[model samples]
Target: MSPLQQPGAAGPVFALVPVAFPAYLHHDALVDADREVDRIGAALAHLGASIRHWPLEPESRTEANAKARMQSWASREHDLPHSMLAWIGHGAANQDSGWLAAYDTAATIVRRGISVDTVAGPVSDEWLERSGDEGAWSIVLIQACGAGTFAKRLIANLLGKPRDPQRLILIGVGSEGAAYLGAVGDALEEMLEKGFSDNDDSITLADFAYRLRAYLGRRVGADLVVHEFAPDGGTPLRRSPVVPGGVTAPVNVYHELRAFLERQPPDVRGHFVPKAQGAELSELAWYFVGRSRERGRVAGWLKDTACGMLVVTGGAGSGKSALLGNVVVHSNTRLRDLLVDAGFIVALPDAEQPPPEVFDGVIHLAGMTTADLVRRLAEVAGINPAARAAADLDALVKALSERTLTVLLDAMDEAQEPAVIAGSVLRRIAALPAVRVVVGTRPSVHDPQRRNPVTELLDALGAGPTTSVLWVPRDTEATEEYVRLRLNGARKAGRLRATATAVADAAATVAGNGEFLFARLAVHEILARPRILAPKQAKALAELLGKDQRELFAAAVTRLSAVSATFDPLMEALALSRGRGLPRSDGIWATVATALTSGRAVTEGDIDQLLDAAAPYILLDVEDGQSVYRLSHHNFREHFESRLAASA
Candidate 1:
């Protein structure tokens, strides 16, 4: 079979609503429930051609009368055709407290119909067993308070029948006594829509039941219980259709990449393989590999070698660093894995660093200097340059061409601003042929024209408007997992102690920044910060932050101010005119928040002319453009206006 054949159990939906006792609550029932009824009816009508309606009401409330009435109804419906289906609504009574359509009545209905499907509150197990022989599928929903125990019994009984396979599917919420048939009906209706197959008369009914329950649990809560009873069911009970992943740690990067890879068949030859090192690098690599696998669904370039490079880039804390780290830890290659095995591996020239020869077939990290990098690349290739007047760039290119090597230059911006490095050494590295070079950096640090070494490499790698860039976003669960692992390690080794929950909570509270998560200094801060601050103080600080406005506006102002001092005062003037500052104040009422969050201060003159210049970041009323000025996010304003520091 082709690896991409769509799974058979892809789309199925079902709902079962059996209102056994309709009389008592009839008054409270929606009088004009036409909208709900029509909506549900229409959805079911699409299920199949057969539709049956059975209103089995006892003639009287007496014990004898109820028994006879149910027997008669059961007998009549027992002969229903194979394709026949029906809906039942009736006045129901507690199985123990009162008599429902009795055993005889049920027997009669089962005789008439080949399969009698009953959806009601928990009925007597004895009564259900008697009707079980006639190809019956009972979808019972116990909708009473505290009905969990009763529902369990009913589910057990229904599952034990002689005709277990295709004979029954039970679903309920709360206890069996407290179960509501309306919910079961809703699930059945949904399943029928998504799961029905016209080609197969015998469907995989249990699979449908399991998938439906999972779907409902996600939409609501997991307390809703659903049971599928089949002696030879296609899927065993232990093997659920859905596989829940680790909620606390980052998801298995291996699994994610594998899933994507499985979706797109890989070419056995000429594929560009990336080797990563460190926790940060592997995490970043996961992002690229995962996306390549996904893109393989639409295009096959990811599995081909025609592409020279696959650049992974994104914002800080977005998961780029983690992805890179995962790539290296799991890699079979020593060079890639050794660097990233610890989550983040920083490589630079050192006395103990491996000689250039050892990096011949692997990625080599050298000093930030272009000359050193170029020299290392040449040495790794073992290409001896002839003695010449000047060491030409061609000498390095020739060595790289002699062998296939993939160079990973992580954190290019960490060395220096891109502008200074972009033109010379970076350009030279990008110009090399028969070699693959990968770089990771933030979008903010990349400006092509001036000196963005990263962009220069990307442009050389053929990145363009139409080309897709690989990105990794933070995974909260993964962060939690990482925290838990770290905390456990510290506790086992007798570090000053705390519970895992407390540690996890603190770890999760930290901002989702890649640099902070992977850096040794950052990890130390994460571990020490909680110990440094009192729990009460931390809680208070978090609460205060919840109310505070964002500081982006102030930061933006700061960025602009770095270019020209006038920018801060301009924004302040706008806030003052808008009433954030009083005209009577000497200094622009520093309370204007936007100016502060961006670390920018507003001047009195800024308030005077705020309306004209800060239009993009500040909203201006067209009718009275100078009447009010407000920052986009409250945090921005608060940062500029308030003197309080982040408590946490």
Candidate 2:
């Protein structure tokens, strides 16, 4: 069955990278193979293939260890039953029979040098038996010399003698360069392109083999020969029907990259979500975990205090956003209502991309500017847009003269020259009859002085007690509950489950060490795979991610980066475009990319795929009808942005 025709065809692409053997072989050869595997894995991901590169660690280079690895792979419970395996390394015909180097493979007297064990025939007798099914078609590409020999030996071993034709296809080369087998690599890429272009993963093995042969004949002739072999003779190498096109989702609403980002005018919605930002925010508050102390304190302040400006300051992931989220959208009914009665118009602003800090007293607003904020306020207050647009804040204040408004702003510290925006524009508005302002901000971690933006703002606000400054305290119990709630919610939602005990244990143990943001991320990573029911695996996974938030951020970003070529650039631009996250505009990012690097390193041309490629890391959120790109957390932004700067 052709992959295109299958209703839900799927197969994973796996590559086995040879070990960094002793110095005898060109060290570059093994390293080149590693690079090739990485390159191929990335490309295959673009074709919507699930790609996995298994680097044989130093310890796994023993014959016994190698066999164990192969056995485990063949028996693993990966969701995909069919697979495409690429063996990227050296190959040779030792004596008469051909041999492919194993992880522990070394030279014998007649061979290169004693590395480890050599596989001339069957890797494991039960490998075929243990695999999903006889009907499942598997393709193995021996991207090394003596590829044909490895294919014949392995197939022969699997069959023992000539058995019925089983669905296994092998492609290998007769001879290979010290570097990657470029001739074959070109052909492999071509075949994949064709299969992907056709939206079919089910390109027949026979067709692919012929294409490979044709490609080799045209490219290098006899100097580098390519061969395809299979058990039951190499007549027709059939493979599983469901073998391609596993792109989980389009990058965004519009699958087209240029259309998604580069359009002259941004996509105009048929209708806007009524106070969509707040409504969506309220929805997000359902999972609002932790920050109980902060919430309670802020709530108390809101109830008794008739009018005051509160500046919540801390480092990223200090629960500032969550604290603000609670006050704005998720706090208890009493507190939420109290703030709302005071005409709470949230300026939790996000720009399309970080605009230059040009106009003072107001941060750059790509999709929605401060003027837009006033207009929105006018709408809520039943004031006409014309009335407000004519006079700006004067009109807004006059229109809402009766209302004592409390404006909740988050991420004020992120604004470029945020002190200007917070002190001038926000303070001006707060000075109105009874208008109050509460802003959340992060400390500038780089400055030697460790100056808090809020300190300056407090002084500007007359340095009075009315300007309340407080840290969102860290709560172990609250964080632990947050973790447990997420994991258990996943269980309830059917995304994952463990024994109630297992879930509880993981939450308690991991959450104890887990930062609130990191705990949420860890849970997200854990659930994407098969359910971790085994007590040890569950604990191990939790422990693995419990190291530090920065480490967790790195792991998450790296995990997504490996699969997509677009992640690095998108991330770099985001890192540099610090204050307001990268705008959703294509041209802006493309320009930022050109400006930040010698070459346009950040722009993927197709920003959508790059955005899509960097998933779970480059989170997509629509704020006030504008699409915004941001790292999952500010901590990640700081870390990655620092790395980008260091590289430059």
Candidate 3:
């Protein structure tokens, strides 16, 4: 079976909220949601998906009830990697915001969710951050009138990052008037059940995301738009059913590429494969605040094979790793354009999921020397490494000339045999055909340190590019920008619960400090909750940054659990979610949390207390109408998971 059709890592999306329209909520769906839900369910079943469904009444549609049901559903083990959550119902959207009308929105009841208004959307602040974990397939699909029009901004607010968070793909319909929601479900089911029956063709969610709009326009005669947001900043990697003027390739190209990549085996241990993930592409796209000129110079030089070799040397903790990572991601994007112009195809193998965009092949060398790196990389290029290992590094690279290689050699000083590897090995490899190398290492700040391995390696290589990164200057500017960026994004996501002035003041304080990690820690702690800070709050946050990285991390954790009783439970759940982020586990955590909270007999009230408190810390997202919760950051999951495991 094609990998696209393989079972999701986190099982299948739970298709909840089976009702088309509740009797209450003072609203109704534009289409028959029940019929639409059933259609998608049958399609999923045909595709061999493992999913769960929730049964609830319209009166039970309060935020609290929905939260509880989602928690119960997620607590079970499906032995899958990732999940998708979809909601098909009536939706309201305006220039300011968008929301799915929940049962709580009845005319007789008060609105529970809203940013500026008394009411808000059911989807939570950490929705994007938590719903998706690394290497899992997660999607949030919403179908409602005006959802298509308001989705771009509304989803940005809900998910925080437009791009797939690690693996989560956020998609929605932006509507003009009435939406043909049922048609969307029908199309998805039809195409999926067919399961790329055409050996020469396969589909990615990206294709689906863009194609949905076309489907609505054609089948329903409804004008609509779709957005496939990526983490490479707020700009969506928007796909259209057709590229207005772009070249069309043979349909078979899709299946051929998918089959080629899927059939390849994972790199064996000892021997290695360059991970397509990392090089901080998406993170850089977002957090990279400055050094546009430097990034351009390096990107341009790398694109030109003549200046294939360059070392970006910097002091420890100066953001060298951060800089190099962004370069590769951006460079690849630039290269993709170049390749497309040259009649070469560049694509994301996992679609929607951002792995390295490859033009032939891209490799990053975090560790490994000239010869060993070449031999191993050759294997990835389908070159028989056993046959080529005996040859010199130059000859081995030449054997793989058909494939273009962008080699990122990060932190070379940390690698074994740094001097020999960087000097002779890297120089020779860089000189080879279709190969470009970018290396990172510690700067030689002192004369005696000139004997530093990197210094010696440069001398040996001779006639190459070397740029020293002034950490303080670069990071200082970037920090302030990052603070502004984060805070702004938080406000958009409806997570920033502080006055604008207060949040700005806190950001200024952190930015002025000029230390990268500490600022991040401070922001994650102070802003993680209400998404903002006040004068006193800003001062407390600034102080919490601590003397160093260690103290800062400790401070961050202290804040995580300081005021919230639900923090520990949420952390445990996040850790247990296996990195797909935690789904709300109303059933699993209630009794366990009650037993742990006080060593005394506890009632359901205690569980309620904890769960209620967790509401703020955990993000609530919906898939197929289930309200799921996830931790705001992976570090929180790691920190709490470690604590839980230790206690156990």
On TM-score, the leading prediction is 2
Better of 1 and 2 by TM-score: 2
Residue-level lDDT of model 1, residues 138-226, one tens digit each, is 33333333233334555555456553334445544443222243454465454443222111123334544545554455443544656
Error of 1 at 533 (Å): 7.2
Runs off by more than 4 Å, candidate 2:
1-273, 276-283, 290-293, 330-403, 443-462, 529-543, 582-616, 619-625
Question: How good is model 2 by TM-score?
Answer: 0.46
Candidate with the greatest lDDT versus the true structure = 2
Residue-by-residue lDDT tens digits, candidate 2, 411-493: 55544555555555566666566666666665443431245443554454444656687776566787677777777877887
Off by over 4 Å in 3: 1-287, 303-308, 332-376, 379-382, 385-405, 411-428, 431-434, 441-473, 559-648
In candidate 1, residue 360 scores what lDDT? Answer: 23
lDDT minimum window of 10 residues, candidate 1? 239-248
Query: Listing every candidate in turn, what is its Cα RMSD in Å to the true structure after a full C-alpha superposition?
Result: 24.6, 20.3, 19.6
TM-score rank, highest first?
2, 3, 1
Candidate 2, poorest ten consecutive residues by summed lDDT? 352-361
Candidate 1 residue spans exceeding 4 A from truth = 1-303, 317-322, 333-367, 385-391, 416-433, 444-468, 511-523, 529-534, 537-648
Give per-residue lDDT, candidate 2, residue 558: 75
Ranking by lDDT: 2, 3, 1
| Model 3: per-residue Cα lDDT over 1-648, one tens digit each | 221332222333333323233444566423355566666655554333444554665566655565554343343233444344555555566666655555556442212232222111333322333454433344455565655644566555545534424333455554645656667665654344221222212234454444444334445543354545442222111111111111111122222222333443322111111133232121323345666555655555554443256667654445666566555544455433433453433332321212234223333332334565556456555677565566466666566455566656655653446667766666766666666666666543123223543446455544634322222233566777777777776777787777667666667777766455455556556655573365546455556643454455545546546765654554465446543332222233344444455444333233334434433234322221222334433334445655667888
